[model samples]
Target: MLLYTESKEARRDVVRKEHDIIMLIGDSLHDFAAEFKNKESTEYQRGLVAKEAAHFGNDWIVMPNASYGSWSKSELKMWNEKAEK
Candidate 1:
C-alpha cells in the first residue's frame, strides 16, 4: 500500500491505518534525499523517517536510489571514471 502525505504527522497518521509494512520510497523521502549534493543538507532524511516510524511503533523501510539518489555523488564519480576509461 502507498500513502502520500506532506507533513510528518500526516505520514504517521497513514501508518496507523494497519498495514503489514510501510515503505517510504522516493527521491525526496527526506530533505537530503533531494539536496544531498548541496552539502548543506546532506544528512539522511531516512533517519528522520526512521525516528518517526519508531515513535509511531510502525514498521517501515526506506529504500534509497543509487543512480540518481542522495548517495549518487560517489556512484556518479565512479560512472564518470568508467566513461573516461
Candidate 2:
C-alpha cells in the first residue's frame, strides 16, 4: 500500500510541477510495486526487471544490498537439493 501510494504521489509530482522522472532508486522490488514484491523465483523477478531493461541506469537505478532483501526470501525451485539423513 505504501509503495502504491508513494508511486501515485510521485506521478502527481510530475503532473503538478511539470517535472521529469530522471531515475528511480531503490534497494528492493517493493519500492516499485506489489508485482515485484517478495514472491516466486529470482528468474521471475529478473524477467520483470528485463521488461524495463532499456530503462536501467538510464532511468531506473537498482541499488544492491548483500545484507538482505526480497531476493533472499524468493523461492528457488531449481536448486535441485533435498534433505539427507
Top candidate (lDDT): 2
User: Residue 35 of model 2: what lDDT?
Assistant: 66
| Candidate 1 wrongly placed segments (more than 4 Å) | 1-28, 31-40, 44-50, 53-58, 74-85
- Report the Cα lDDT for residue 60, model 1: 35
For all predictions, the C-alpha RMSD in Å is 8.4, 6.7
Give the per-residue lDDT digits (tens) of candidate 1, residues 1-85.
Answer: 3345465545545666775334444444442223223344333544555546562323334455555755554323443666777
* Tens-digit per-residue lDDT, 1-85, candidate 2: 1345455445546555765656667787655545675577778878988886786777667788889866677665554455431
* Local distance difference test values of all predictions, in order: 0.45, 0.65
Estimate TM-scores for all models.
0.28, 0.53
Per-residue error (Å), model 2, residue 10:
7.0
State, as a TM-score between 0 and 1, how close model 1 is to the true structure: 0.28
